[model samples]
Target: MRSPADPARLATLLEHRAHRLRRDASAQAEQAAQRDREAQTLRSAADKRLQAAQLGEEHGLDRQRLFERLRGVAIARAHVLECELRAGHLQEQAGDAREQEQQLRHAAAGNHSRARRLQAVGAHIDQKHRQARLRRQERQIQEEYTCR
Candidate 1:
């Protein structure tokens, strides 16, 4: 059975936890980036559709053709609006993912700091133990020499 107060063991555990948190944060950041790219693509498509509609409007045509063109423009505008809404939703999701990633990163940093402190304490304890052992050995050697 391992002692619960073992600093080395506690440090290892904290280090592992920090690693996992960092991995999770990296994954979240990737997800946020993907969402941003998708949103940009949607916005690009919407812009293209709006431009086409504008170009169609600048052309003069007969009444019947004009009405047909207006209908097409209205449909295109509706599609653009829909695209904008979807892009907005994606942007919102990306923002949320970014926020989550930041939080995870912060938590990971805190855990890493704790692990480092624990490791330092463990090293100090080991050094003290080694010094004590050396002192004991030196005292024993001195006593043996005196006995001789």
Candidate 2:
């Protein structure tokens, strides 16, 4: 059975942490992609609205109708602007998530390195113990043969 101080055990713990970090990073990346898509969708809707407003203006109309058309266009423009602002906020949130993910990844890597170092120390200790045991056995044999 491996002892509590075993390098393998420490490595296992570190690996688990690394896996969790990687998962988090993946989630953040997905969120970023979602935000980018939302921004694009908002921009497209705004363009469509602007095009419609221009087309409406192109049609010949009485002054009263023209004033009404302007009002409608103004409302559409406001809606478009609002959507664009919301999309921008989402994009910023996504960027923050991505940065958090990167930090987690770095932490996981550090843990992995620490685990490896611990394992090396454990191996070195084991080797020294084995050499001590062998030397003792050799000394005992020499003493017995000399006495005989």
Candidate 3:
């Protein structure tokens, strides 16, 4: 029959899983940042469009030209709103990923602590066995001397 996996090995696996989770979380954060940048760009574009429309109105643009500028401004604002929504969604996803990563790291730390405890226990048992063996050997030598 196959032997069960040792605690040290299990701890190593847990560490690896934690590392992977952290990497995934970092990627998620990067994606969220990218989305934020895109949203900001869209917002800037909308602001510029609104400013141009305002300027045109102040300069006494004809009614038809003013209407067209207003329409463009409206469309730009809508795109900005959509981009902002997507950015917000990405930020939420990133936060969730970070939370998951933290949970996994905690679990991994617990596993590592258990593994260390098990290792200490194993070492203690080995030390006792060694001491017992030495005592037996010393007793045998004494008996041999007495018999001689």
Candidate 4:
């Protein structure tokens, strides 16, 4: 900005970090929900198939193949449930990491703001010292001229 000494830049950085953390956290949550939904859908579909097979087996030679298919579906369901659980865990981890990053970024921003304040204070002190020296020199000059 026009005022390079302004504190707005630090604010903007902190805002950006907060925004990113929220975005990432939401994304992780959504993905976890999606995976859970997928696993549930898969289980429902398999259950429906098994139910249909059981009903049809009363009519003819559907038992053997149906049993095999059901077995495979059971295996697939187990695998899908495992995958869903893993996805959920990963999402949780992502959320935790995002939280940690947010905390770190916030701390960094605060530290940065403090550092800038200290620098500004130092500069102001230095300026005052310079002005004091200038005033002393001017007084010495005036005294000598008056004596002459």
The best candidate in terms of TM-score? 1
lDDT tens digits, residues 1-148, model 4? 1255434454455556656655665665565566556656756665665555443334454778767767766776666666667666656665665566566556656656665675566567667779999999999999999999
TM-score per candidate: 0.84, 0.80, 0.69, 0.56
User: Candidate 3, residues 5-122: lDDT per residue as tens digits?
Assistant: 6544554565666567556656756665675676567667756765665534267678998788778778767766776676667667656756665675666567566666766665
lDDT of 4 at 117: 71
Judged by lDDT relative to the true structure, which candidate is superior, 1 or 3? Answer: 1
Pitting candidate 1 against candidate 2, the one with the higher TM-score is 1
Candidate 2 local lDDT, 17-42, one digit each (tens): 87888788888888888888988898
Greater-TM-score candidate between 1 and 3: 1
Task: Show where candidate 1 strays beyond 4 Å.
Answer: 1-4, 55-64, 142-148
> Compared with the true structure, what per-residue lDDT tens digits does model 1 show for residues 31-94?
9999999999999998898878763435568889888778878888999999999999999999
Model 4 vs. true fold: TM = 0.56
Q: For model 3, name the residue pairs that clash.
A: none
Q: What is the alpha-carbon lDDT of model 4 when measured against the actual structure?
A: 0.62
Better of 3 and 4 by lDDT: 3
Q: Model 2 segments beyond 4 Å from truth?
A: 55-59, 136-148
